[model samples]
Target: MHMVIYALVEASTKDEALAAGKTVFDRLVGTDAHSCAVFDYYVTFEEEDTSVAGKARWGDLPTAVPVDSDDGEELLDRGWEATKEEFERNLERVREALDEFSNEEIMRDEDLARHAFHQVGAYDGPMVFLYTEHASGIRHRGQLDRILEESENPWIVPADVHF
Candidate 1:
């Protein structure tokens, strides 16, 4: 399977963003990272051909929507009720499993909770970082945040990667 990862780079122009993104990727994920070359897939929010590249500006990135809210339903909807139903069912299963585990046990196994509930990752803060499949990007979030702090105008770029 392939996933789209949103990478936030601090730069005032597209070329700058691309360069910064490449540097960040190279430093953190290495030059020969698995799946895809970061440079080959990086695209601005203004790009029309890539999925999740609809926003004309970084400021337009949408906030995370609660899974049970109407907006979440709309976001998950693809003109099929079955899709939404399946998503809800999966979410319910996760919730049930959580109920069965103690808070300390759940805390000790953070990956379990992140994997179960963060399937559809979204940016919900002042700055966006590289967001990939729930676990991958999150694993490096702290590093990305520190790296981006040195940037001027940070923006998210969507890149397609194979899994």
Candidate 2:
């Protein structure tokens, strides 16, 4: 998800860039206030290197969607629904924005001039951070742990199960 977002916004315009950032924030808030609550927003830079060679290429920034939970069951259904929508909508929007940028006459720094007229596989800029998505639903895993610690339910911890 991080790689895709960065790649999609590799050489985007000002207005489009702001829109992309806002979309990420909206998704995070809607998903789990706990996780999105930790992040600031999608980080990006207007003036950057669009080169395609070197170890510091733009696609290497942090992309984890940070999340925390005090009560998992409280947001189970709502969190799942929002998470799904975030992934789908953002993916499509990013692709569309990149495609639109590809048509413009983009100019880059001297080091990146060689590839200015072409669409390389990934970003060669200074920064390219993408949004994060929750892997395990917000509180489910922790709920499992809490059940293990607070309950004597045999099914929660199988008799034959060993870690």
After aligning candidate 1 to the native by TM-score, how far in Å is the CA of 112 from where it should be? 9.3
Residue pairs that clash (backbone atoms under 3 angstroms), model 2? 35-67, 65-132
Each candidate's TM vs. the true structure? 0.36, 0.23
What candidate 2 gets wrong by more than 4 Å, as runs, is: 1-74, 103-163
Tens-place lDDT digits, model 2, residues 1-163:
1212221121124354344444444443344455433222223333144443111334332222111222222223333344345545545555555555543422332333324322222221112122222212222335434533553221100000001
- Give a tens-digit lDDT track for model 1, residues 1-163: 3333454544556566555544544433335444333233333334455543334322233233322246433432321233234446547756865887778866666537645555423221111234422212432335554544654555444433332
The number of the candidate with the highest TM-score is 1
Candidate 2 versus truth, CA RMSD in Å, comes to 20.2
Against the reference, the lDDT scores of all candidates come to 0.41, 0.30
Error of 2 at 8 (Å): 31
- How accurate locally is residue 25 in candidate 2, as Cα lDDT from 0 to 100? 42
- Consecutive 10-residue window with the lowest summed lDDT within model 2: 154-163
